[model samples]
Target: MCSRRRWGTSPRRGRARPICSTWRADWPGRAVPTSRNFSPWRHFLHELAGVQPDDPVPLDDVAELRAWKERFPTRLEALLGPLPSAVPPEVEVVSSEDCGRYRRDKIVFDVEHHLSSPAWLLVPHDRETPGAAVLAQHEHGLGRGKDEVCAVDGGDDGLREHIRTHRSDYGHQLAERGYVVLATDLRTFGERADWNPPHLYACDLTHVHAAMLGRNLLALDLWDLARALDVLCAHPLVDPARVGMVGLSVGGTVTLFLAAWDTRVKAAVVSGYFSSWASSAAVAWNMCGSQVLHGMLGRLEHVDLAAAIAPRPLLVESGTRDDLFPIDVARAEMAKLARVYDRLDAAAHLEHDVFDDGHRWNGERAYPFLDHWL
Candidate 1:
């Protein structure tokens, strides 16, 4: 006798049905019944398994790499929808202060027609001529943005603890090293969060609203960052030819994409955010609306995006104890990216700094890497 088991109730009939009915039970000999619990998350994981790009661009050699660079940005821009038009970033210096080793200037600048951004411009007093410059990107936090990167004095205990833990004040560090650093607030963070509802993250609401209008939060951020670059380059102490970028977490995401898309960024240091998308998707809160691009998973991965920055000096930093972005996955992805750099004969230009720490700015190798490259 064959054992019968109830599978699921029928929606229309509202009756329980045996997983193995007579017809299914025997055709030539017998049938096997497979049972499993239903889970949307599990289904999503299954869907993501072994996914690859529909039209993968080649990265075999210099020519192929160049072709991939040319072709991939178009595909990426499509996913990003449209970007705002370029405008003269009418940079205005709001105020300036002489902080021990460097001068900190509060400035405002235009990003788009009606959009503007505020930032901290740190210039080292020792710099005698126009020298290397860096666009320092800040991580995500409540009542925290460029302030964290610039090491501003006041914030909530959480923000301070985060700064202490992550050593989040790399912009100030760069200034001490004689690089003029521009750290700006991405939209929905710090001073830009005025439109946010009480107790709600501004990025969530802005991402939702932008999507409704066929825009993307990241695209908007990239636009603003580009304009910020205009202001950074236009500074008397900055040489446009010697520009680099560095960021961690959400800041790292923008750093990676912006370096890939814009040629002006001569070097980039991406920290705390270099693992695969599949790895990130496993954790529910690891991804957000602002970081998403429509239909990106099947078409691209973090390796591909990082690879696009190849032939250009890039240093990727990963922390062993960073649970948010697992170190093992970052190592695996970096291995894949290494192949692209090798094929381009730019292996020397690529470096991975795996540190014994948590999700934070490990600039042990980063400072020297930028000095060597920029």
Candidate 2:
């Protein structure tokens, strides 16, 4: 899921020499490189967009998207290193219950993680007709208490508390319609990345510490998602070829990245968070530390990430009143993507549903698209 390139303010569109034979940072002036075949211009392009590097890249065409995603799982493997090819010894399902209205059973399982991290996996009880699974991704911000991503009803007052107070409709709704739903937590959110009380570091200070490793929490969180996929594929009921992903806000951001980087994900729904970077940076007050890139303003835009999902079915749900991402910009960005998908001969698969709301998922419009596609 790539964003737009803010060309006017991006680093000069100059060619970059390889940072080094081994690492990108070793390169000379203006060159940003990494240990792998890092694309500094791509990096700089992200910076120009006012979105952070940890954000997913926008897709431009089916060919381009497929090419980038082909090796994503491999790259992730390199990062996490030889993940459990089989379920971890500590993996266990602790509980299961039927949510009467949705007609799907909610099951909670635990995976003992190496980082001393423990993850809870929630799955819908319904069985798939054939090959199908939906990765119900969660947003960031929760550090404990309750995870709202797993709740079916968001509850009164409608605050959208994630798993604790609501079941992510994106996940459970699809399960009722006959798809195995996989919902899990990302680092620093929900139970996986919870820090002890009196957090070692306050939320606002994450960026300063990220400088120590030349990385950010988003980068690390995404890595965890990639690993979760490994476990998802290992399940007997899961279909490796027909996996799809859906998320809102932060979850939507990761959905874009996961679809772009992981071939295993066949479709995606990027909700509430899809919008043009140019307009977003200019007006949205919600832009946070890692949300804006170091030098992306002049090169790519929000639509680019949508382009990356080319050839694959993608549905973007935008809230008309969303303060973080303008609806008009989202429509325009989606239009840019429509052309790219058309060029790839997969135009029929692209779709967008806009609603009158702010920053929250409409839920009603997105699931049917996933049903039709995956």
Candidate 3:
């Protein structure tokens, strides 16, 4: 059977059904969303919510697009906090393993002033040089870090099963396809989580600490991603000029923002996360702390941030039955962003795949899209 047609027929599909069937909850971390005084609180937030109606005028020229792009990033900085400046740390190899067509290296590097990050760099064997590369970010899955994407040994059976259900190994997939791939853990996962007290989920505690200091995790995550781009470009075989990023869930959240902030990401594929935040975050409340940007809606819509990468090849994947980002909303915002891309005379560069599946990596379209563009 075609794999796409078998999204629901995998051996563990029955066990994984509840992972998506239970809406308002995110898998791998944190609790299900709950607005205690549902109606009153929602209305209260609605009064304060401020996703402005995007400029209706199509950007007819590059100059107009440039103006549109310049208008919002400053406001975003105020909301997400400033993107940091850090010297690139030297890459250290911890281990390397041959994973069939690709060789995987377990490496570590400093992403911030004192923050070290664990990552897996997967490079294809007997491959051509000056080829494309992808910075693949994994889902915001609890305890899942670079290991999940690199198909590294997870030690725990449950963790391995979770990775299987999510198909969260696309970094390995991309590398085996001949693209150099770097999969990095974010702030709260893997060895970085060692600092927090043992009982706490790192994400929960990290959110609290970041907020206590009047900063947000989103800022740090973005800075780490930007720095990682520099490292990816430094790879000898990677075409520094041709790099892209693809992620699922929170990773998709990072993908859109990374592309927006850095032009070095020549192309992108954002899966399972780009929809009307007005509908999901505001109403359904299906968002996490790490993904939040205070007052983001006041200046820009999700589609607008996405369009900031306009005229570049972009493919957004949405599952028709995915509750996290409803298909109707995904299609609506996609149409809106398509118009923005159309302004640059690069409408063909913008596309969306409405998959007949749920929230996971739907690479049937994404892989080809990246290969075509990068």
lDDT tens per residue, model 2, 201-226: 33235544554556555555555566
**Cα-based TM-score, every candidate:** 0.86, 0.67, 0.83
Q: Which stretches of candidate 2 lie over 4 Å from their true place?
A: 1-90, 98-113, 116-130, 140-146, 152-168, 193-204, 289-300
List all candidate RMSDs to the true structure: 5.5, 13.3, 15.7
lDDT ranking from best candidate downward? 1, 3, 2
Error of 2 at 98 (Å): 4.5
Tens-digit lDDT string for candidate 1 (224-335): 9888888988888889999999999999999998998887899999999999888888876677655777677877778888888888999999999988899999998888
lDDT of 3 by residue, 1-374 (tens): 21121113347454433322333333346564575455876675766574466453244566777776777666567777754558667889999889889888888888777677778888899766778999999887756677877777558788778778788888988987889999998888766565545655667677777888877888888888887888889989999888999988889999998898788999999988999667676544467666877666545667877888887889998988888888899998888788788777889999899878888878888888988898
Compared to the true structure, candidate 3 yields what TM-score? 0.83
The 0-to-1 C-alpha lDDT of every candidate, in the order given, reads 0.86, 0.60, 0.79
- Sorted on TM-score, best first, the list reads 1, 3, 2
Residue pairs with backbone atoms closer than 3 Å in model 3 (clashes): 28-142
Give the higher-TM-score candidate: 1 or 3: 1
